[model samples]
Target: MDLEFMEAHLPLYIEAAVLTLRIAAAGILLAFLTGLITSIIKYLKIPVLMQIVNAYIELSRNTPLLIQLFFLYFGLPKLGVVLSSESCAIIGLAFLGGSYMSEAFRSGLDNVAEIQTQSGLSLGFTRSQIFRHITLPQAVSTSVPLFCANIIFLIKETSVFSAVALADLMFVAKDLIGIYYKTDEALFMLVSAYLVILLPISVIASFVERKVRYAGFGDTSTVSG
Candidate 1:
C-alpha cells in the first residue's frame, strides 16, 4: 500500500515502456522480412534452401521462446557472441516471431493464385520479377491481418525478457510491485503498458485490412486465368 513509492517509480515504468516498444518494433521489422523471404522460398520450392528454412521455422515454432531467449543471452556467449539483454531479446523475438509469421505468409502465399505464376511466366517475367510483382504483393496483402496479430503476440512476448534479466516493462513492473507491495497498482500498470503498446497496432491493422479487402485480394482481376 505504499502508493507514494509506486507513484514515484512512474518514470521507471515509462523507461521500461520505451524499451518494450523498441524491442517490439525492431523485432517485428526483422520478423516481417525474414518471414517474407521464407514464404517466398517455400512458395518457389528452391530445393535445399527451402528444406533448411522450413526446418528452422518448424524447430523454432515447436520450442518455447523462453528457451530461445536464454540460449541467446546465456549460451551464445560461450561461442564468443555477446549481447546486451535488449539485443538478445530483440534477436530472440525476431526468430520466434519470424517462425509464426512465416507460417502466416506461407498460408497467404498458398492463397495467391497458382495461375499468377504461369501468367507472370507467360509475360516473360523472371523468377525474381514474378515474385516481386505478382506473388509478394498479394501474399503480403493477404497476410496482413495475421501478421498484425503476430506482431501483437510478439509485443506481449517481450515480457519473457524478464526471464533473461532484461529490464523491460514487465521486469520494471515486477520490481515496482516488490518495492511498494502494491499488487493491484502494479498489475494495472502492467496491463496498461501492454495496452498502450498494442492498441495502436490494432487500429492501424484495421485500417490496412480495410484497404486491402477493398482493393479485393479475391477479385481475380490480376491473374491470367
Candidate 2:
C-alpha cells in the first residue's frame, strides 16, 4: 500500500465520510418516521389509507435505490421538478429504507398480542393510552435489533450516492482510483473508513439487543394480568 498516497488522501476520505454520514443520518431519520407512521397505519387497519400504505411498501421495497436515485436526480427534471444531488441521495435512501423499516416495525407491532390490547381495554385504558403505554414501548423494545440493522443497512446504501453525483465515501474512493491509479490505497481506505463507521454501531446494536432480551420486553409472560 502506498502509505504516502493514503496519508495525502485521508482528508478527502474523511470529508466524503462526513457527507455520507450526514446524508445517511437525514435519510435514516426520515425513513424511521415514514416507517413508524406507515406501520401504525397498517396496525390500525385504516381502510383506504391501509391499502395505500401497502402499495407504497410494495413499491418502495421492490425497487432498487440506484434506480430511485436515478429517477430523483435525472428523471424528474424532464417534468421540471429538479433537486440537487444531495437531495436526491437523501430522498432515495429514505424511500428505500422506509420500506425495510416499515417491515421491521410491523413485525414488532405484530408480536404484540391482541390479549394485551384487550387487557388494556378492560382496565379502562383508552385506545391511545393502550398504544402509548403498553404497545409502543414493548414494540419498540422488541424492534430495537431490527431498527439497528435497518440503520446499518441504510448507511451501507449510501455507497450508491455517487451515482447521483454526491461526493460520498464510495465516490471519493472511486475518484481517487480512477484519477491516480491508487486502487489499492483507495480501496484500503474505503474498507477502513467503513469499518471505523460500522464497527461501533454493530457492537452497540448487539449490546442493546442483549439488554432488551434480558429485560423481558419481548416476553408476554412477563406482563401481569
Candidate 3:
C-alpha cells in the first residue's frame, strides 16, 4: 500500500465523496417522489395509468441498471434526446430505485387493515377523508423501515454511476488505481468510504423501525355494533 500516494490523493477522494453524496441524495429524492406518485396511482387503480406504472416497475426491476444507464446516456442520444452523464446517472438510479420503493410503499399501504377504512366509511367519512385521516398515517408508520432500507440500498447502488464516468467515489478510486498502481490501497479506501457513508444510514433506519413497531400502527380494536 502506498501510504504517501493515498495521502496525496485524499482531496480527490473527498471531492468524489461529496459528488457521490449529491448524486445519491438527488437520485433518492427523485426515486421517493416517483415511487410515491406511482404507488398512489396504482393504489387508486387509475385506468391506463396503472398499467403503464406496472409495466415501468416490471421493466426497471427486471433489467440491469447498467443497461438502463446506457440506454439513457448512449441510446437516447441516437434519437436526439441527449443527456449528460450526471443526468443519466440520476435518472437511471431513480428509475431502478423507484420500482422497489414503490413496492415497499404499496406493501405498506396494503398492510393497513381494511377494517380501518370500513370503520371510517361507517362513520360517513368520504373515501379521501378515510385515507387521509385513517389509512395514510398507519401506512406511513408501517412503511418507514422499508423506505429507509430502500434508501440505504440506493445509496450503495450509487457506486454504479462510476461506470458511466460520473466521477463518484468508485470512479475516483479507479482513477487512482490506474495512475498510482496502488490497487489495494485504492480499493480499501473505496470500501471504507462507502462504509462511512452507509453505516449511519443503516443504524438510523433500524432505530426508526424499532420505534415504529413499538408505537403501534394505529388502534386495532374492533368497532362495537
Candidate 4:
C-alpha cells in the first residue's frame, strides 16, 4: 500500500482537502444566494425575470455539469473571455447547484398556504410584511432539510472539479496514485475523506428533518411539483 509514500504525501492531501472545502463552501454560498433570488422571483411571478430564471433553471438542470465547466474553462477562451480553472469550477458548481436548490426553495415557497397570505393581508400586513413575517418562516422551515441535502450533494459534486485540473481532494488522490502507484490506498483515502465530511452532515439533516416534520413544518404533499 506504500504506507511510507502516503505518509510523506499526507500534507499535500490535507492541503487538497482544504482547497476542496474552500471551493465547495464558496460554491454552496453562491448557490444558496442565487437560488433564493431566483426562487423569490418565480414565486412572485415577476414577468420577464421569471422567464429568464425559468430558462436558466431548465438549462442548468437539463445539462451536464461537466459541459458547463468545459464551456467556461475552454469554450469561453475562444471568445476571449478567459477564466482561471478555479474560477470556472466554482462558477460551474454554483450554477449547477443553484438550479437544484432553486427547485427546493420553490417547493418550500409553494408550501406556504394561500390562506396564510390572505389572513396576513386581512390583518393589514403589506405583501412584503406578510412574506417576511409569515410566509418566509414557514417556507424556510419546510425547506431546510432539502436545502441541507442539496448542500451535501454539492460537496460530493465538487469532486468533479478535478476534471478541470483543479487541485481538490479527488485530484490530489489521483496525483498521489500516479506518483506512488498505490491505487488502493489512494482510493481508500479519497472515499474516507468524503465519508468523514458527508456522514455527519447527512445525520444532522436527518435529525433536523424529523424535528421539522414533527413540528408540522414538513408536509410532503404540500411541497411543489
- Which candidate's lDDT is highest? 2
lDDT of 1 by residue, 93-134 (tens): 889988888999987777777677887899999989987888
- Give the alpha carbon lDDT tens digit for every residue of 161-188 in model 2: 9998888898898999899998999999
Write out the backbone clash pairs for model 3: none
In candidate 4 the C-alpha lDDT for residue 39 amounts to 97
**Per-residue lDDT for 1-225 in model 3, tens only?**
778877888888889889988888899899999999999999999999999999999999999988999889889999999999999989998999899889988987887777788889999999999988888888888789889989988888888888787898988888888987889989988988888888988998999898886325344432221
Candidate-wise lDDT, in order: 0.83, 0.89, 0.87, 0.86
lDDT of 1 at 13: 86
Model 1 Cα shift for residue 96 (angstroms):
0.6
Tell me model 3's lDDT, rounded to 2 decimals. 0.87
Each candidate's number of clashing pairs is: 0, 0, 0, 0
Candidate 4 ranges with C-alpha deviation above 4 Å: 211-225
**Once model 1 is optimally superposed onto the true structure by TM-score, how far is the C-alpha of residue 118 displaced, in angstroms?**
3.6
- Which segments of model 1 are wrong by more than 4 Å? 1-6, 119-129, 214-225
**Model 3 TM-score on a 0 to 1 scale:** 0.93
TM-score of each: 0.87, 0.94, 0.93, 0.92
Candidate 4's residue-wise lDDT over 9-92, tens digit each? 778778888888888888999999999999989998999999999999999999988899988998999999999988898899
RMSD of 4: 2.5
Model 3 lDDT, residue 118, Cα: 83
